[model samples]
Target chain A: MTTPLLEVTDLKIHFFTDEGVVKAVDGVDLTIERGKTLCLVGESGCGKSVTSRAFMQIIRKPGKLVDGSMLYRFKKDDGTDEIIDLAKLDPKGKPIRQIRGQEIAMIFQEPMTSLSLMHTVGQQITELIRLHTGATKHEARNRAIEMLQRVGIPKPDRLIDEYPFRLSGGMRQRAMIAMALSCNPTMLIADEPTTALDVTTQAQILDLMLELQNDYGMALLFITHDLGVVAEIADDVAVMYLGKIVERSDADTIFNNPKHPYTQALLRSIPKIAMQRDELEPIKGMVPSPFRRPVNICQFQPRCNQRFEACSRVEPVSTLINENHSVRCLLYEDVAAVHQADTEAVAHG
Target chain B: MWQYILRRFTYMIFTVWIISLITFAVIQLPPGDYVSTMVSQMINSGMDELPPDFEQEVRAQYGLDQPIYVQYYKWMRNIIRDGEFGYSWIYRRDAKDIMVERLPASFAISAFSVLFIWMIALPIGIYSAVKQYSLADYTFTLIGFIGLAVPNFLFALILLFISYKYMDQAMIGLYSQKYETAPWSLAKFWDLVKHLWIPVVIIGTSGTAGLIRTMRANLLDELNKPYVDTARSKGLSETTLLWRYPVRHALNPFISTIGWILPSLIAGELIVSIVLNLPTSGPVIFNSLMDQDMYVAAGFILILSTLTVLGTFISDLMLALLDPRIRLS
Candidate 1:
């Protein structure tokens, strides 16, 4: 295994509210190798989005990162090795600011809200270039024009000068992507980039991101709740539940042989295009609230169909089920016995 | 935008007419006749005792014996035809002429107060909000509350007392040392500004406090916006993040509120003028009411209403310019 480009260990983010402490992100462990894509898949309030925001240290007040560190390793221009803990950087200082757009860029969910409506689309992209790369205005403009063209915007020059509201939703998302990739970042964290977009635009943006990722060979931490998107772009996948990674494996393994019951449910929930279903079989019961501290092994026990007494009594540690696959479920432990029982039941039937 | 302005102008005219009619009716109604009140006051002070013909004399002098609608019609006719707002029974001058004469002084004082308030406010407000619970923020907040708590009149009185103690005389409001019936001159303007400081500062202090609190709340709200978070995530400097992003968006609310504050500032100045005894509109309007000077009070009300409407219009225009989303309609 090569050294991961980014490593997050034991991340615990909590919000101190009047009601109680909300464990928005608890004991989250994530890793991304260079030139690979990792998707964190979960429903809302499951801490997938929170984990993405933690990388940028943009958590607002009443929210504190109680425990954890995100380490980024990079090779310097002088050929020296550099490692920095993202959590400890002064949020206002130049070092973090320099690293933000230049080394690690992000594409947000709502393009309308994220893009400055006051500025021209072109001006915003150029301004970012000038700020991080010290490019002159002319140089920035030329680069912005190039980036806008690269993102498949028609009449890139005219579009650059146009305000955000004047553009279509797809154009705005592409513009956001153009701005994010303008600095040639080593890592791109896209938080639900296609949730607000139409299906056709979503497919376009997904294709664009894949093309850019292949071209740059940068690590991509794609955060989404859509299993379809995960299937489309992700090389490695991690399933998150109530702020913890429930399962991690390659995209193929997670789709074919889902080890965790929650992962299985998520797979089954995806509707097939061939079948014309009126409604989706949404997972039963709401995700357990993070108001109380999570105890025991399986947070999924309450909703799990395969649950037993031991599942509720003891917490399960992550057990390696195969190469490049690990799951935090009691069923995965001593799999030979479980497999034998399943085979015997099938034969009897 | 042009259509919007034209519509606003039409509305302004309608609003001014309504305001004028209200003033006219209030004065005409059963409280006291403008002419008889004057005659009765003179009669009460034993200056000269008039016979029963006194009412008749007053009625004939001002053409008040006419029907109420006819009287209003004549007044409106004169206002539209000659731009004459009739004559002030108390000041013995044309109402419109007196308003023109007094307007510059009131405007100068109000403009100065507004400028001073903004200059002192924006920085302090932004700083306090950014620092949130820090000691500097707490201190400024405490001072802001204290500033808001003190009445404008009391604040003027404190300054007056301080000036009296130091200068051995009443250092009053925005009047020159040679202000009594003096012609306009540079020396007089300079002296007026020197004296203007007390009233302007006092008038502006309370408003300054209110504005700081407003700006702080608005900017703090903008700070929490996801766009600001997006800007910060781009690795933009804090100053860049604030000025380039939230400040522009935050200013929209303040720009809109300026319309409301214009009226408050005028009311504030009225109090400051009375307490400090400067010959600004506040004193004139107050004295006119006390003496039941109908034409002078009515004329002043018309001017004040016009100013309030225009101030609001200007604020709306500024908001429209700053934020593209707001259409004129």
Candidate 2:
């Protein structure tokens, strides 16, 4: 395939909080190509949001970039490619700034708070446009109005003068999208953007996003815990459990044949209309707190119904099963002698 | 919005009325009126023989013979009809005239202290918060604790001592010897500026430290907010991200502080005024209190409390303007 617009390899973002090192995003790998959507799906604390924040290097204080390489390839205005290792850029330096909001933009989970209440939504959009494009304020105003219209705000003129508090949740989320896309960024990272909206609004926001992605042709990194949303909008799906991606595949494969027990469990938990009326099975146990993560075992081994002796002794590494599927589960591993020896060791004990 | 302001304005009038009544009552609470205080002073100073009708004449001159509510009504009528706050027994001048002369000095120094306190506090607070746990943050944090620990009077005295010992100029008042009573001129202005620095430093240091601690805490909380993250993710420069988003969010409480700061500067300056010998209303009203100059003390109390109430109204108006969330409500 053409060079991925962004490729993250073995990314680890740890928050050095007072309690201890929180391995919030540990050894995650992700990729998204231009004009395509990749959904990073996980329950809370699985580090989907943290990994997306890694791209912008906007993680909160007490959070550190322990180790990672995020290689972002941009097609410059002249149509030639430039690749930069995003991890190494000083978060406060000049180069990262040029790429930020200009090359990449993001929408957040809480539409209520994602846009500053103190500033007019139009001013917010215009400010970003002006900052990145060096356009005159008047020109940016026009661009902001145009974006507000494109995002389906009525009376762009009046709405342009209004603050975020005046807008409804869907409208605010749309405003956020409008602001994020104003620069025609090379990539858009949306962290659970529609999770807070009502069902109808959520669908509309997803549709607006997909439509906007088509219009802008930007790579989309969509992070959400909602599998239905993943099924609806994701071109590629990566299922995360406890800060690691345990399964990666195209949407259909991720749903039809999830290999990792965590992904299978997540798929099972998605309520279906066709299923017999029954109480939904939540994953058997709570996600282990970051401070208590097992150092050398599969993080999901405790919760995995199919867990085994080897699962408790060693961390399971990703094993490629096909051109489009990868799984991190010993159940799918080709039973090697090391596992046999490990099982023997456990048996002797 | 106009309705809100009008309602607030009405409340302000009521507030001022209640404040004036309370101050008048409290001034009366000290067990003697101005004539008693004057007669006692005369007795202590060897003028033991009472002049015929001396107490009666003194009492009649100030209208002190009326009942309490009647006296209040007379005072309120004078204020309403002629803008007169009554007469100062000690200065033997109209209280309004005393206010006119003294208001400027108190306002100038106190206003400067308020402005100086905020200007110094906000930026330091923002910096300390954004770079929390950094060396500068720790250093400023230490200073902030020190500011909170030491009383304002002590801080003022320490500054006074330092200025006297080091500068040798004493920096004793809001103006130097020649300009203390001098009429307005560029020379007076410069001297005012020169003297202004000492009180501003004396008063502002502690205020700056206190506000910095508060602003830092408020901004730090806002810095973690989702809007701030969104702003940063949009690649707002660190300065832009700070000043425009989280700082703006953090400013509501700080703006509301304007009400507290207005009278605080004036009230907090009283002890400092005594220490530095500054010719501000603090010491003037303070002397009135000691001499039991009823009208002057009550008048100053009335004016300062009005300012405090007015300050709260102004801050509320500002809050409504600055925050749309509040504006809608």
Candidate 3:
């Protein structure tokens, strides 16, 4: 199909701590097309947040992106397109900074604390606009108002003068979104934007995001643990187990016919409305610590219910089950041979 | 905000009343009256005891013959009647006169020390925190420890000795003998500035070191916050992120600290001012304490405690104003 807006190949980010090396984001490949939402679904510490940080080159001290190529494809003013490797550019250098907020802005998890307490919401939004676009203060402020209005915040003029703490959680998240989009970024990375919010507010924020996404045509790299949230907004879904992607497919395929045993277990664990009388099923075991991770094997082998000898000793290679569907599991090693067995297992169930 | 301040003021009055009681209790804690101290000092100064009835006359005049509660009641009544500070037994002067005479010099030194502390501590504190574990941070850390280790009076003596031996600077007082009684003039002002630094350094080194550690730790804590990364991701430069988010966030602690800082500065100066032989409240309080001048000593304590309460209120209000999160709450 068309060239993706961003194609990340074998991104390996590790943290060298006093205790041991944490293979936070290890050899994971992900892609986001222009104007599409790609959700990185995983449990906490499964490298989803680290991968998002790597995208912006914002990985903190002791954590280094040892190996990766994040090839960002974008259109220039002359209508010709260019490809830049975000991973290669110095994180704090000029080139990456020019691209970071101007072309790729990020929202954070905690709405209460994501914006600074010292500055007014307007000032923060104006700061982002000016930092990237070289706009004058007056121009930046006007643009900030426009963005705040666009984010569905009521009374943009008044809210502009208020600080983050003055607003409710939903309003704060909206303000955060407003700040992220102030520079008219081509990509928006949201790290669990609604996790700290209540249910009704979460739905509102998610709706606001979807509307904003449609308006801006911005590629959205949404990192979250909530599968339900993924089902609502994602265009492509990448399920991460430990530091690797266990499954990558279109949203429909991921939900309807999850391939990896890890994905199957995750999908089964989601509580359904009609199944209220039924007790919720949890995964059998805990995720292994980063220090205890086994080398040269599937990360989920120890926790996988459908483990075999090959799953333990042999490293699983990604196999394409069909168009736009792939799984890193020995169960799908030979998709053509296993295709019939998969259909039978599904049909029988 | 007005109502809150009013409430705080009411509470302050109540607290001051309680503090006055404590001051009275401590004043009465020692066994002898002011007459005994006068007698002893006279004897120490190579004079025989005053005429046999001299002690009885002095005690009767100062109402030292009254019980503790009666004395406390009378002191409180005199304070309320005309806002009059009581009589000083040692110098036979008004308590207000002593405070009025000493207040400006003591105030100037304290203000200078605060300014010096801020000016030196701020940039170094920011640097130490930002480039933590660097050579500069380590050096500043070592300096901070040394400054903290030396007692303020001892530090003043050390500084005085060093200046005497090497620089040959006579850091004796807030001003030279001429300016001591001279009217305000340009030359007098310049001389004050020249001698002003001695007490500033002597009193401020420990405060500066303490504040540096505070600013460094506070900034370091703010640095690790998630908003810092969020700001960076917004294309804000490293410097911008530092001052905009973390530095502004750090200003809260500094603002909150200004309350207690004044009293500590005053207390620190009380010791250093003596070491440097500065003409401030330290010597007056010292002489009053040694001679058992109860009214003068008690009056100074009351003024100091009132200043402390007032300083805390002002700082708390400032904190609320600077930080909207607290203001709204």
- Best-performing candidate as measured by DockQ: 2
Per-model DockQ: 0.66, 0.78, 0.64
What is the CAPRI rating of model 1's predicted complex? medium
Candidate 1 interface RMSD after superposing interface residues: 1.2
DockQ winner between candidates 2 and 3: 2
**Tens digit of per-residue lDDT, candidate 2, span A1-349:** 7679899999998898889889888898878888889999999988888888889888776788889799999777698988899999999888888888989888899998888888988888988998888999899999999999999999998999898888899999999999999998889989999889999999999999999988888889999999899988989999888888889999999888778888888878878887766767788889887899988677888898998778888667788899779888777777884477577757866
* Residue-wise C-alpha lDDT for candidate 3, range A167-251, written one tens digit per residue: 9999999999999988789999999999999999999999999999998899999999999999999999999988899899989
TM-score for chain A, prediction 2: 0.96
If you assessed candidate 3 against the hidden native complex, which CAPRI class would it receive?
A: medium
Find the candidate with the highest lDDT and give its number: 3
Residue-wise C-alpha lDDT for candidate 1, range B268-301, written one tens digit per residue: 8898888887767877877777777777877788
Clash pairs (backbone) in predicted model 2: none
Model 1, TM vs. native: 0.91
Worst 10 residues of 2 chain A by lDDT: A337-346
Error of 1 at B2 (Å): 2.4
Model 3 chain B: weakest 10-residue lDDT segment is: B1-10
Tens-place lDDT digits, model 1, residues A54-94: 88787777788889898989779997869999878776677
In angstroms, the error of model 2 at A152 is: 1.8
Predicted structure with the largest TM-score when compared to the true one? 2
Worst 10 residues of 3 chain A by lDDT: A337-346
